[model samples]
Target: MCTYLKNMEGYKLKDLKLKEFDSIQEMFDRAFKRQKVKDDKETTELKQLMKIILDEEEVEIDVIPLAVKSPSIIGWKIRKEGRKSYYQIIRADGKSQTYMIFSHMLKSFDREDLENLYELVKAKYESTRPVEDLDLILWGDLKTMFEPHIEDKVWKNQQDYKVLNWKLYDSCGVHSLRMQHVQIYMLVEKKYPLTPSTLTMMLEKKLMIDYESEMAYQLLKFIMK
Candidate 1:
């Protein structure tokens, strides 16, 4: 834990009462400002980073378990001056279910992103949603919303062809097909069509998710006729 966090002796993470905040921006302001390290050199840096994260409307916070392996860290860091800040992550489940991490950004918090995070937390004051949902959603959706040029890193650029890749069209009102190898059936509703293969790649390649999981299979089946 950063020395700044330690001295907020009375302010437990849960006691910070973040559930009251209706927006991600509000939650971040409360979380960042409850500082035990007011005098630290990194205080201003953290404040600035918090602002950058909050200004976005569609930011998603993903809390990786303490044991998960991390990918590369990139983005602005004033402390390091245009370099990625590096730190070790440490967690202990035995006490207070506390998770701790060291990094430019890591999920030291215990909760991950739930689809109904606001809803679940508002009702139960705790969310039971699986953390895997966060991993799948944030790595793709959050990147789409906040990070710049993530599409180039994930899927082929469609700029030259002026086309959308991996499109799905419903067929026969019974099943859907990936447009490339699809057989069109009943063309009644003219909406909600799907293609299994293209949809699979949309979730797999575009989302950077694996194909073997039951969730992946189910999503594919739902899209295919």
Candidate 2:
């Protein structure tokens, strides 16, 4: 039994035991059946909607599901003649958005561009935001700001990155600063994949800052409401 459990590649022993499944194969078969039912339901609903929206007899639609704490169906990716269109359900009024942000991100940026963007954000944060501000944002525990492995790198090779004094600021600005830093850190070191589509989305959203007055001023604007 121990060797069998060890040999199971993807299935966890705890999960199998908790689910009262006799074997890993059985667990997978049951999960597959459940997912198949869900996929069928989603496909049927999405196909009908796509046909109506496109006003065509035939349309190929791919349902894109957002993976969240409580996962829910979100949108459809329609493809025809080597072109793609995204439609996302966002509000209660039965109105849907033509542009899907997630799909746009996936289609826009590449890894190198993302890395460059991370560096730019980090440089901006370091230059514009004061060390004391970081302390204020993080409640004086600067070391805990980033993950354990990258703490030293983030702290500029210091053993303890502490601020001698802290000053309180407007709650909104402080919140933005904290969010800016957290987002850059996560994008550079965590889950964000360095892909072409991601960069394109950033540019499309006007989130990228530039030295020029016009472009820099435009950074705050987004196409979406």
Candidate 3:
């Protein structure tokens, strides 16, 4: 097992004082109880979809509603006595439905595994792109632009510099750098509506990377521009 997972083995939801609802509706009700506007049709439909997916997958999950500005539901699944945790989110806008299972646990990954994962994420991102946007700048574009300026060969020596950046930044925070990357891309393209929480979900489950040591700070700097 991964060291991170091992460290989390003793943790439990109840230990955090998190109350799990028996059904998704109950969870939503609790989440929106204080709000003047209740859960809308889009949010309801998305919750139903999440329930179906969980049932079909036979996943044992604890449905927890988030108390954020946007209406969303999160399903948490624990396996092997908290040795593994999976988080799945469904948003009202329907653009951010995805599962973040084990990919967040990157401490156990070797260089080759990280490379393969990076390639997989790149291919998936490319496949989802619009035909007209195929040539647009990507994580690789940023990496290529910055590689020659980097003095340390350790960053360049990796099979894919993008993966190296992801490793370093993910180690810093769960999805900090990737979220900033998405924010920058959205700023540059003037598209893709994003919020801090939704962008984090996309990074963990959908949106997928750059650099060596300074990438996260560089991403922050880019956003400041």
Candidate 4:
């Protein structure tokens, strides 16, 4: 090698064929710029998702989601020792609300496709999410029970309606109302340690019944006050 070639230096040109060193620098600059653009896009999309999931009003005795930003979570669940576990839950009140999510009701994302992505940033707690998202559907799954209650006499009326087979299965804002052939309590009872979607499938398979006052009243009367 010539003495001039050995001594000439700025950035290393060994990777480039010496003549293409300038081209290599330009390529590096463009690649870094593209990466920045992708990051900005992800941040914006993620923020929009949070707005829908994190901002929701809690329904009475319902496991509804609270407000949360990305890298935040406030799901409802029960603990093994029959106690509530407290966490910094983002609420619709535009402030941080603390809720003791029952550990029993916490659902882990089990999809193999998303499992690898989740493993990227696993937390000590199973129910915790890395960020908060928005919930566009305000009513969510509990919408069916919010309907009017009807019966032979005045089941629709709150005064005449009796708490028959009702039972508080899990402490994650879930309850079961019993009536006639349909029983909705089991639906909530089995949701512990699983996602709501999982329990929904159990109902679809005819393993669960709809909201029925008969069983709810009977169960509540026998088991709880």
Candidate 5:
């Protein structure tokens, strides 16, 4: 855990009260004022990610869980010239979600293209309606958004593509397939309307269902028709 976050852990945003809120605002103000022009790719990425969380229009209690990831980046001391910061992501869930998110950006995107990618992601996420299953939506949709710009390193292995897809889905928030499948269906349907048989084949081969999940079953059926 970052030392700066030790005092603030588990403190949900809604319960901040006046004093606690002020303290966090102070921390954010300090971070903002001292923000520098970053030269390195990693630092720049961290800065942008943190900004997306901190700059949200509304802060609520549930946001604390997602917001906790912010301190991990600031702790790296990336803002200070010449000093490299390493983050030790600690989570009780036996998974370092923040590190996974950061690593996905570093590994799957070209250093030069991360800013563009993050901006597009942030915009798309903000514009979309939040759903109970945000990951499903984001991951499936990301295939369309990111298919064009995958780093050469990432494309070397097809499985890496799947890994990056899921990582972004999990980190971004809840998932659904609303926008993703809609976009795909629209694109393909304009050229060729999917026949019932073709859609059934897609359900069998393309859609990976562990069991007979209702959402998966319905989505495949809907797409085909």
Candidate 6:
């Protein structure tokens, strides 16, 4: 039993006697049944949606270039917390926008697969030769979210990357009604340790700094009311 427990990654079976094994087995059996039912339901729903889309009279299928049709994995960042590891892959839409996919508890990656992905991004970057002509935008990291601001202000002011745009996303400007407000609320909720009221105050100040005082006040009054 000691050897068996030691073989486990971080779990201990010493406290779990043979009597508890039956209960654990039963619980896993029930969970498996529940998952199968849920998967079947989702499969049926997807089939129905696919049928409807295929049978629609006015539905159109416009062919796009192969390059534009596929999502490109440009870069990645790896993070480790204790024994768990996470992989955040940066994906570009072959257009101007980029987003991140945060993977949970990734077990491992094939060396050849990673090499291929790196080469793909490198090729894309090289295609736009004469480096000075290439333009790119990288989003801020959630970990060191604001340290760049202090560094930029103190020493790199002249070379600082200007706030080309803000409010959730640069491309999502103006077209998304009330989305910027929702984004601010979500950002505060996810990234900051603040209550709703405090977040509102912080957002108001941030907007004011961006010369959006009127919008800031309106948001505060509306949300607080």
Query: What's model 4's TM-score?
Result: 0.21
Provide the TM-score for each candidate, comma-separated. 0.21, 0.18, 0.20, 0.21, 0.22, 0.19
TM-score, model 6 to reference = 0.19
RMSD in Å for all candidates = 25.5, 21.7, 22.3, 21.6, 23.8, 18.2
Stretches of candidate 6 above 4 Å error? 1-70, 74-130, 133-149, 154-166, 169-202, 205-225
In model 5, how large is the Cα lDDT of residue 182? 37
Report every candidate's CA lDDT.
Answer: 0.29, 0.32, 0.32, 0.33, 0.33, 0.32
lDDT of 6 by residue, 119-208 (tens): 654455444532221122112122122222324322233222222212321111110112222221122112332245443433433322
List residue ranges in candidate 5 displaced over 4 A. 1-96, 99-201, 204-206
Taking the tens digit of each residue's C-alpha lDDT, what string does model 1 give over 1-225?
A: 444344444455676566454553454555457653443544343222111112212222233543552232221111221533222222233211111111112212212321222232234322343344323332333233223352343323322222122211111111112223222221122233233433444444221121223333333444333
Residues 161-212, candidate 2: write the lDDT tens digits: 2222111111111101112133222222222222343334333333321122
User: Model 1, residue 12: what's the lDDT?
Assistant: 59
Ranking by TM-score: 5, 4, 1, 3, 6, 2
> What's the distance in Å from true for residue 223, model 4?
39
Question: In candidate 4, residue 208 scores what lDDT?
Answer: 20
Model 3 misses residue 32 by how many Å?
56
Tell me the tens digit of each residue's lDDT in model 4 across 1-225.
233233344434564575576876575666556666876785454332221122132422333444332232323222222443343333234434333332212222112212222232233223453232211111111223332233413233333233334334322324544344433323332322322433333333221222333333333232222
Q: Which ten residues in a row have the lowest lDDT in candidate 3?
A: 48-57
